[model samples]
Target: MVAHSAAKKDTGGGRESGSDAWKNYMRRQTITINYGRELPLAQGVEFKI
Candidate 1:
């Protein structure tokens, strides 16, 4: 499951050194991915967004 929370301000280091600092400084977001009817199970499983 995806959990949404606020993002912390990054000091910039490690793997994220060259990455956009704005991405880290931005607030958290919630994205709901829909797999639709492509899943094999009756309850819908294994499908991806």
Candidate 2:
């Protein structure tokens, strides 16, 4: 759940393509991953279930 807006500034496509034209800030990022408890490969190899 990430939301950020405002973007439309890029003047570069010549002179070796290099320019952001000073992009006036625009960012939005979110990553959430939760995983826990996991142990079971072959409960018969002396792992005893």
Candidate 3:
């Protein structure tokens, strides 16, 4: 997902737009992963780790 987001930033759209798309995608993906803690959304990292 991160790779896809980075690729999109250069090829699909600008940084903010691609990042936002990745965020929305992450939200949806994480919803199903059932992480018990609230998302550490500050940098949109850690949740996946």
Candidate 4:
């Protein structure tokens, strides 16, 4: 699992003194597998390790 944060700022026109700030949060997941031997992977089929 991974966590990420992003911030954005927008400056207004026409006599605006301050800027608008926005934040975004996101999460992601990744999976990894280790194999002992090299084998061919077939689509729509399960292989036993």
TM-score per candidate: 0.16, 0.14, 0.43, 0.15
For residues 1-49, what per-residue lDDT tens digits would candidate 2 score against the true structure?
0122122223323432222322222111111111112225434545333
Which regions in candidate 2 have their CA more than 4 angstroms from the true location?
A: 1-39, 47-49
Q: Which candidate, 1 or 3, has the higher lDDT?
A: 3
Cα lDDT for residue 28, model 2?
A: 16
Which lDDT tens digits does candidate 3 get at residues 1-49? 6786577757857777777877898898888675544444445565454
lDDT (10s digit) by residue, model 4, range 4-38: 11222232232232222111111111112222222
Q: Indicate the worst ten consecutive residues by lDDT in candidate 3.
A: 34-43
Provide the clash count, candidate 4.
0
- Backbone clash count for every predicted candidate, in the order shown: 0, 0, 0, 0
- Regions of candidate 1 where Cα sits further than 4 Å from its true position: 1-19, 28-49
Which pairs in model 4 have colliding backbones? Answer: none
Q: Looking at candidate 2, what is the lDDT of residue 33?
A: 17
Which residue pairs in model 3 clash with each other? none
Q: Answer with 3 or 4, whichever has the higher lDDT.
A: 3
Cα deviation at 15, candidate 1, in Å, is 16
Q: lDDT of all predictions, in order shown? A: 0.33, 0.26, 0.69, 0.26
Better-scoring candidate (TM-score), 2 or 3: 3
Judging by lDDT against the true structure, name the best candidate.
3
For residue 20, give model 2's deviation from the true position in Å: 46
